[model samples]
Target: HEAPSPEEHLQARTSPLRIEPPFCQQTDDFAHNSTLHGISHIFPYERGWIKRCLWVVFFLGSLTFLLFVCVDRIHFYLEYQHVTQLDEISTPAMVFPAVTFCNLNSFRFSRVTRNDLYHAGELLALLNQRYEIRDIHLVEDNVLEALKIKADFHNFKPRPFNMREFYDRTGHDIKDMLLACHFRGTECRPEDFQVVFTRYGKCYTFNAGNEGHTPLITTKGGMGNGLELMLDIQQDEYLPVWGETDETSFEAGIKVQIHSQEEPSFIDQLGFGVAPGFQTFVSCQEQRLIYLPPPWGDCKVTPMDSEFFESYGISACRIDCETRYLVENCNCRMVHMPGDAPYCTPELYKECADPALDFLVERDNDFCVCEMPCNMTRYSKELSFVKIPSKASAKYLAKKYNKSEQYIAENILVLDIFFEALNYETIEQKKAYEVAGLLGDIGGHMGLFIGASILTILELFDYIYEVIFPFSHVVYIGRNHYSKERGQYFTSLRKNCLLICSHIYQMLAL
Candidate 1:
C-alpha cells in the first residue's frame, strides 16, 4: 500500500467509521447468549423486518405486563398486611392465675373502731357529695358535729385520714372471712393470702407472685382441682350508714377477680360478683398471644417505661397515667393508685382527684400511649352458680356455726375456681407478606412470564457493568484529554472505539 499524505491521514482519522460501536456488539452478544427467553429473537441477524417487528412487540408487551404484576405485588408487600391464627397447645402444668376477692361492704360494722368510723363516715359523705348521689345527708349529723365539721357539701374539708390504717382495722379479716380454703385436695391457711388494697378498701389475693414469691401451678384440670373457698360475706356487718351509692357497689356479694400475677387488680372494672347463698364455679381458659412489632404491628417489643410498675401492661399503663394526672393536678395520689406520692386526703379526692379520674375516663383515655405488648397472657372465665345451703345442709351448717339457718343461708357462699383444660390457646399475629415470600413471588412471576431467574438478573447486571462502565470511562477520558476541536474529539473517540473492539475480539478469540 502507498503511504498516505498528511491531509489524507487526517481525513481518515476524522471520518465516521461504518463499523458498529463495541457496546453494540456486546449488546448483540448478550441478547444471543442470555438465559432470558424471547431476547435472541428480537435481535436476530437474518430475520425479516416483519418478523423482527412482531418479536419486538411481543417482548415489550410481556415485559410490560411482568413489570406491572411485579409492581402490584411490591405495593401489596409494602402495605404490611398481617394475619392472626389460633392454635391449641397441651401443657403439663399451667401457672395458677392470681385470685383476688373483696367484700361488697368494705368494712365490717362491728370491727370498725370509733376513730375509723368517724373518719370513714366523713370520707363516704364527701364521696357521695362529689358524685352528686344526694345521700350525703345520711351521714349522722352527730358524727359531723363530733368532728367539728359543717355539713356544707361544696365547702367540705375532711380531717387528715390515714386510709391504709383505717381500712386495715375495719376491713373484714381474711382469717375470719375465709371459713375454709383448699387447693388440690390440700387445706390452705389464711397466711397463704396476701393483703392487696384495691377499690374495695382491703382485699386478699392468692398466688399474686409479685413479691418475688414463686408462682403456683396446677397440673390437673376440672372443678375442684384448683382453689376452693367457703367464704362468709358477713351480711350482719354490712351497715346502712357505710353504704355506697355507686350502682355496682350496692350489691350484697363478694367481688372476685382473676388476673395475671404481673398485673395489679382492677376490681371495680374487671371483677365478677358472686352473691351469697350460691356456690359459684369459675371455669378458666388461658390464652397466650404473640404479636409482631412494626411495621407489621404497633405492638411494643420492650416493657413500657413507668414510674410505678416493673412490668408493662395496658392496665398498668392506665394506672400510671392516672397517677401522673392526679399528682400533677391534685398533688396527691389515690389510695388504690400506685405511687410514692402522698395519698389524697378525702377532701382532695372528692374535689380534684375524683374529677380528674373521671375526665381521664371520659375524654382523655387516649392521652396515655399504651401500646399493646408483643407477648401477653390472658385468662377468660365462664361462671356457673348453684344455690348453696340446701334445706338439709342449712340446719347442719347453722348448728356448726351457732347461727340461724336464715343467717347461714344468706351470709355464706362457696367459690370454686379451676381450669377448664390444661391446654392453652395461642393467638399469634404474623406477617402475611414477608420479605422472603415477596422475593419468592417475584422470582416465580419472573420465571413464569419472562423465563428469567436470579441468575438471569445477575447476568444482565454483569453485562451492563462490563460494557457500559468501560465505554463511559473511555469517553470521559477522551473528552478530558483530547483537543477542543470537534474533529479532534471525533478522532479520539474513533481510536478508543477501535481499542475496545480489539479487546472484545481478543476476548472472543480466547
Candidate 2:
C-alpha cells in the first residue's frame, strides 16, 4: 500500500478497533492522578467479581445503617421533646381542700294558727323564699348566689320568714334553721359565747373574731346545704356546749365524703382532701351535739390571729400576718377593715394597700413561706335529727337510745371539725416525665435491639466525608487523550514485532 499520510496514520492508530493492553499506553502526569487511581486506594475497583460484590454489599449496608440512624434520631426527638416541653410548661395542682355542707334532714315545726304538724318537704319549699335550700333550679341558675348563703346569709331578704308558716310547715324539725343560725353568726359576737342562738342577730359592730368559721382548706362548694339539717359548729367555740371535756364523742349521723374528684396520688392525698377518706355517721334517737377525738393531735400549725383577720375572709390568716408585718413596718394597715390597727383610716389604707399587697406577694414567693398552719383547728359538722319526748328523763333516754343505737340512728350528732393542712402539696413543681431517664432508656433499647452504638454514627459520617472530600484529589483527563495513548501503544507494538521477525528470518536463511 502507498505510504499513509500522518493524518491517516494517526486516525488508524486512534480507531476504536485497535488491539492493545491498557498498561502498554504512555500516560500523562494528570492521568496517573485520575479518579479511578484515587478510588483504588480507598476501594479496589480491579478486584474479582466476588470482591466487587462484597464491596457493593458493604456500601449498601452502610447506607441502610445511616438511614436507620436517621430514623432513630427522628423518633427520639419526637418522643423526648415532650419531656423538655413539659418541664417548661406547668400548671398549679388542683389540691385545694373542698368543704361540702349539705343538710341531711329538714326541721319539723307545729302550726300555731292551725294546730297542724309540718313535714320536712313543706319546710324546704318555704325556706326557699328566705334562702334557697332545695330548689335545684335556683341553685343551678345562680350557683354563685346560692353558695353565698352557705358562706354567710349577708344578703338575706328584708322581710322575716313567716314564723307561723314556718312552724306549720316543719313540726319541731329545727336542724336546718340551726345550721343557718351558725353560718349567719359566723361573724360572732362576745354574746355568742354565752349560748347557741335560735337566730342570728343583724349587727355589724361585733368583732368577735373568726371564732365562728375558719377552715384551713376550702372548696368550690363553699359550705354544703340540703333538705336535711346542717350542723354548723366550731370545736373551740362550742366547747361550752360540749361541757368540761378535753375530748368528746358523738355520732356524725350523716354521710361524710370528700368531693375532690382528683386522680388518686400521693401528691393529691397530701392537700386535696382528708386521708383514709370519709364515711357516714348515724344517730338513731339522740338529739344533742358532742365533741370527738382530739383533732389532728400533735400536728404543728402556724398560729394566726382570728380576731385580727375576721373581716377579710375566713382563711385570711396569711393576709393577717402580712398586714401585721406592714403595720409593724409602716405603722399602718391596709384596706382590710376590722383589722388589728384601729388607726388605719380609709386614706391610710388607700396609700398602703398596694405596697403591702406587693410585699405580701414577694413574701409568699418563698417556698412554704405561707404554709398551712399545722396546729390550727379545722372544723366539720355532722347534722341529724331524732324525735324524743321533750320531757323524757335524761337517764331513761340515754339508756333507751344507748351509744351504739345512737350511732346507727344518728341521734347523738357529732361534728368533726379539723384544720385541713397543706403539709403534702406545698411543693408546686412536679415532673410529667424524667428527661434523663428517658434518653438513657432509648439509647439502651437501641443498643440491645439493633446492635447500634454512637460509634456507628461516627463511622457513617466518616464514610460520607471520605467519599465526598476525596474527589478533590482526583484529576480528569479527556476521553480523547486516553484513546490517543492506547492507539500509539498498539501501533508501536505491531511495528516492533515485524522488525524482530524480519531479523530472525534473515539469520535462518543464512
Best candidate according to TM-score: 1
Tens digits of lDDT, candidate 1, 1-510: 898644455455544432235766787899999999998987777888888889889888888988999999999999998999999999999999999999988766566444443444445543233333235466466443433332233554445558667677778899888899999899999989999887678899999886778989999999768999999888777744445332124678899999999888888778999999999999999999899999999998876788788888878877888789889999998777887898876567667877778777787857766889888888989999999899878889999988899988889999999999999999999999988998999899898888999999999999878877776766775565554567766665677677667767888999
Instruction: Write the residue-wise lDDT of candidate 2 on 1-510 in tens digits.
Output: 698744455555545444232322312222233332122332444568777676567555655665676577556644433211111212222132222331222122122112111211122232233343444443334433433343243543333233324423432223322332232124322333211111110111111223553322222122321111233222211101112111112221222322221111112112121111122232111111111111312222334435643222223545455556677756865322235464443233335644565556565565224433332222233433334323344355446544233332234333333222212212122233345655666566545444446665565465555544433322232244556676767666577566557767877999
Alpha-carbon RMSD, candidate 1: 7.3
Residue runs of model 2 more than 4 Å from their true location after superposition: 1-49, 55-101, 106-410, 414-510
Badly placed stretches (over 4 Å) of model 1 are 5-8, 11-21, 126-160, 241-248, 483-510
lDDT comparing candidate 1 with the true structure: 0.79
lDDT of 2: 0.34
> lDDT of each prediction vs. the true structure?
0.79, 0.34
Query: Each model's TM-score?
Result: 0.85, 0.27
